[model samples]
Target: MSAFDGVKVAVLLFVAAIAQVSIFGQLHVFGAVPDILLVTLVAISLLRGSVAGAVGGFFAGLIVDTASLGTLGLTSLVLTLSGFWIGRYGETTGRDRAHAPYLSIAVVTVLYELGLLVVHFVLGESAPAGAVVRSLLPAVVLNLIVTGPVYGLVRRLLRAMERQELSAEVQLLG
Candidate 1:
């Protein structure tokens, strides 16, 4: 990507961070907080790549770490891995199927929670299994529900950009 793409990504990440911190977390849907950053990281990874995903995860995690007052790299590490996995998912699987994003988010959501639980354990903070389950399951379901629309919007932007690039390439060739 050129500087333009890089800047776009950074702006989106910043917006996502701000939204996650100021907007999403505070919005209680019957006491269920939206995992806006996590979902954004997931979308970024799928739309971008593993490196982008990892970077997004790292920064997002740093924000969470700072906000929550937990260990510095806990969220950074977990979200980085999640982004990496999603990027890998994008590479390994073709995106022709309509069901892919929803399914992928559903599976990745559980794994992300488990990874966070492990991080908490390593950090010497013990959470009851029930608490972990409670926090994770709802977040996963909500993410799955939200993934479809988000993916559609992201994919459309990507496709439009690709078309522009393709047109430029054709013109150069001619």
Candidate 2:
């Protein structure tokens, strides 16, 4: 990716992180807040590759951790893994799939919540498995609901870079 592309992604994630903590974080529906940052990260990962996803995940997660004054590096770890795996999926079997975004969002939402629970347990914090399980369906639903528009916007924003990346992948294959 070009320097400009990197800057654009950074700015995008920065805005996403800020909005996530400030706005979406406050709005609760069905006792669950929509994870806009996670959806945005997934969209970027689906367009970019593992490295970009990992970096973007870390950047966004750090912003979230800082903004919320929560445990440092907690979100970073989970989101980094989530982004990398999603990016790999995009690079491999999910690139052209119509349901990639929806599938990724649904699966990652579950995994992200489970990951947080596990981490909290390990750290002797309040795990609250019951609450997480109760909220899982709603969170996944909310994320999937936003996936179409978020993915479209992200894909549109990164269209040039995505084309370049796809051409490079094709050339590599041939």
Candidate 3:
């Protein structure tokens, strides 16, 4: 990965984390919250690939774990696996803007909840079906709803970064 890409990813992680914790929590529907980090990971996976997805998920999850009542590394592990699978799928399947990200995010929100369930179970925590249904369902819906616009932003940022890279390359070759 280019150093620029790394920097971009870092900035994304930072913003995503802050947005998740600060802004997203402020807006509530059905007593639910939007998971910007989750959406970000899915978008990154669809737009880039599994490796980038994994890194994004890892950082996002780690931040969540530290920021909330949940156990440490739970989100990290879940998000990392989610990102890996998402990225791997992206690599095998051609990305189409019309529906790929929406489809991926739709499915992934469920997978993310599933991963959380498994982690909670492994940790000997009680499995509350209502947690996902009552709380996370709305969160998932909100994430899917926001995915399109957020994905566009990520795309725009990537294109800008790509232009910078291209300019740098041309200057080097001059």
Candidate 4:
């Protein structure tokens, strides 16, 4: 990706992180809050590729951790994995599928929540299985509901950026 693209991705993730913490964090629907950052990260990772996704995930997670004053590296690790694997899925089977974004978000939401449970358990924190189980499906549905619009927006932005990059390259060559 070009430097400008990277900047755009970074800014996008930054805004997503802020919204995840400040807005969506409190918006609970059936006791399941939508993870805007995760959905956004997955969208970007799908468009950009694995390395970019991993980097974006890490950066966004770090910002979230710092902003929320949570345990350092907790979200970073989870989102890094989320982004990387989602990117791989995009690069492989799902890239061209019309349902890829919704599928990715649903699957990742389940896995991400499970991963958080494992991390919390390993860290000697109470990994409330009941809570996780109860919220998991609802969260997946909520994420899927938003995935369409969020992914569409990100895809449009990336396509526009890609077109600009290609036009610039053509100009330089001409």
Question: Best candidate per lDDT, number?
Answer: 4
lDDT of each: 0.74, 0.93, 0.80, 0.93
- TM-score for each of the candidates: 0.84, 0.93, 0.84, 0.94
The RMSD of every model to the true structure, in order and in angstroms, is: 2.4, 2.5, 3.0, 1.9
Across 4-102, the per-residue lDDT of candidate 1 in tens digits comes to: 665666666667777877788777654356676777777777777788888878988887778767789988888889888888887678345566677
lDDT of 4 by residue, 24-139 (tens): 99999998999999999999989988998999999999999999999999999999999999999999998888988998998999999999999999999889999999999899
Ten residues in a row with the worst lDDT in model 3? Answer: 94-103
Off by over 4 Å in 1: 28-32, 170-174
lDDT of 1 at 149: 74
Candidate 4: worst-modelled 10 consecutive residues by lDDT: 157-166
Steric clash pairs (candidate 4):
none
Backbone clashes in model 4 = 0
Give per-candidate clash totals: 0, 0, 2, 0
The TM-score leader among the candidates is: 4
After TM-score superposition, the amount by which residue 172's alpha carbon in candidate 4 deviates from its true location, in angstroms, is 10
Model 4, residue 100: displacement in angstroms? 0.5
Candidate structures ordered by TM-score, highest first: 4, 2, 3, 1
Residue-level lDDT for 154 in candidate 2 = 86
Error of 2 at 90 (Å): 0.3
* Candidate 2: tens digits of C-alpha lDDT, residues 123-166: 99999999999999999999999899989988888898768878
